[model samples]
Target: MAFEPLKGLRVLDLTSVVVGPVCTARLALYGAEIIKLESPEGDLMRGLGGQSPTGRHSGTYLHLNRAKRNICCNLKLPDARKIIARLLETCDIVVANMRPQALARLGLDHETVTRAYPGTIYCLITGYGLDGPYSGFPTYDSVIQAAAGIPGLVAARDGEPRYVPMVMCDHVVGEIAASSIMAALVERSNTGKGTFIEVPMFETMANFVMQEHLAQHSFVPPVGPAGDQRLLSADNRPVRTKDGWIAFTVNTDKQVQAFLDATGKGDLKADPRFATVRARADNVRAWFAL
Candidate 1:
């Protein structure tokens, strides 16, 4: 049978753009009823994501909001409180990505919502965590990419910083937020209690970058510089073949050996610098040049 574990669950999506929509979209895919609440002006992505045939539903907006229902409410008006209250009563989960202050003002922040609906699972996706110095600061994918050292990594490899050509930070953080919400659901099922989950984009992406690039600097007394030398190598990119360009990665010994053999450089397998993982790591530039 097709798995749909979240069937019948109602999600109140108090989000506007990519990150929060990404989370609710995943829940919707798992059979949750996503109630996407938007302001009168509508989601920024509707216009910012790109041109659309309808001039209202941009491709990015439509893709992220699929399998969901939408409600337009201007929470700033007192009359809209009733609608929010009614939705809160029926919703099993609330996922939001607005700034903390704005959510708090609308009485949709974790504290207010959890206090009113103790059984509701609340997930807040923030550009920065509530307690951080950068908390409540406005941010987007490119800003986050810069804050999380993505462009810096590129600059290390190519000598120039550049934002990734897509909203990678939002997609990654959104998926992570979805995973966190699912985990909270599991915990609630066991404990008979709801949970408050916070997914921060800057911290999450920073941790992601560090997991691979911290390298020897992870040691207490830094033995070497941060950043993975292999990843930072300029030659660690697509190779030119006669027909076109080919991009491939060979990390394991067997894969490396096979790659060398297939490329008619099998004799390099005997070379001390490319014989094993450790050797290759120690001689990244030379290994990548091959």
Candidate 2:
């Protein structure tokens, strides 16, 4: 049998789309009992990602919502609200990825849930932070990718601003939210207190991008430029060989020396421009040309 870390925990998953569902799916996998709250019409993802045999459960939806119980509710109805309240009373955690205003209107916001169900961990996932110009703005994976400079980075390499061809922001933020929820649960276990966590897609994705691309711009009076030149280099892709292609990275001085020796250009290792990390970073284009 597999280990069930969350064997007795219950999660009221009020999120319908990718981010929240992804988070709860992970929790469910860890043995939490997940009640996936949907509407009378069902989640939008249920109809997305192509047709199913029953035409109700799309592959994407099925994969994202596996190992969970589904419940249909109309939050506008008083009876449904009572049912949600009852579920909230017993659940250890509640997660939602709806618009802030929509969540507030439905009385599912963090403030309302934390007050009503003391000690219940409330996790809210949003496109942007709660109080900003873009707060409450509708967003999807592609929009977040563009906003977080993904397309721009792609443009730097490919000459055209293109999405990363995947729902990267949703997946990354969802996992992050899952980790945050786990941390909150641990804290609750120790203190017997509830916690409210907000996972904002835009800010999270921005930090993700900058962690690598910030480069010298991470310092005041910028040492060089914002982006890592080696990563942004057009020649940084897989090298084409006679029969196939091989992908490799030469980051450290020793690795560069080894690559040079392997290519029978070991003499280049002694070159002043390629001798040190700083020098190589400064002359990355010339080094790539070599």
Candidate 3:
């Protein structure tokens, strides 16, 4: 038997592209019935993600939108409100990634939805928060990553800023949104009320970066620089073998000693610079170089 806890729940997916679709997709995976509402022109990722045999559904689109029903409606038309209303009447949740202004223009904003259907779990995934200066500004995954200091981390290591070669912000924020929706589901079951979840990509990803890179600078009296030296080390990468590449890590003294012996560098075990964890951390550059 399948673990379908959300089997009976209907999710009205008023989202397009990666972030919102990613959240609803996880809900669908957990057995929620997802009805993806698409514009007549369809999702931008349908064509933008990659090549498609039919020239409509790209691999990225298919992967993200899997196991969900779709509805084609032109929200610009007056009659479309009727369609949305009907859908909302039966939906247990509404997940949207559209900007606040755009959602308001379409009459699908959080306030409108919650006002009409107080029991609807409304999840809005935005690029920025509702009150900030950047709120409602146009943004995407790459922009969010850059805003979150991801490229800066790379620049610290390689002297050049670069994206992670994937829509990492979208994926991270989407999974977070899914977990948040699940938490809301739990809360609603107890309180008999829905939740308005706002997952801002910029804030969320920035917090993620800060959690790791804030380092010694997290305190008022800074002990050291902001970035983690070990993480920013240029040598912190997969090592090349004769046949292929191999990635491994040795943190504990025992593991480090074993690594030294295995790599025919047993002499380094007696070296003060790489002897202890503290020494390795203090000499991160030299430790990584070894």
TM-score of each: 0.95, 0.92, 0.96
Stretches of candidate 2 off by over 4 Å are 1-3
Q: Tell me the lDDT of candidate 3.
A: 0.92
Write model 2 residue lDDT over 125-233, tens digit each, in one string.
9999899799899899999998899988888877999999878999999999999999999999899999999999999999999955688888998998778788788
User: Regarding TM-score, does 2 or 3 come out ahead?
Assistant: 3
Clashes of 3: 0
Q: Ten consecutive residues with minimal summed lDDT in candidate 1?
A: 48-57
Q: After superposition, how far is residue 22 of candidate 2 from its true place, in Å?
A: 1.6
lDDT of 1 at 171: 89
lDDT of 3 at 154: 93
Q: Which candidate should be chosen as best, given lDDT against the real structure?
A: 3
Which tens-of-lDDT digit does each residue in 2-98 have in candidate 3?
Answer: 8888999999998999999999999999999999999999999888767787788899999999999999999999899899899999999999998
User: Of the candidates shown, which would achieve the greatest TM-score relative to the real structure?
Assistant: 3
Error of 3 at 287 (Å): 0.9
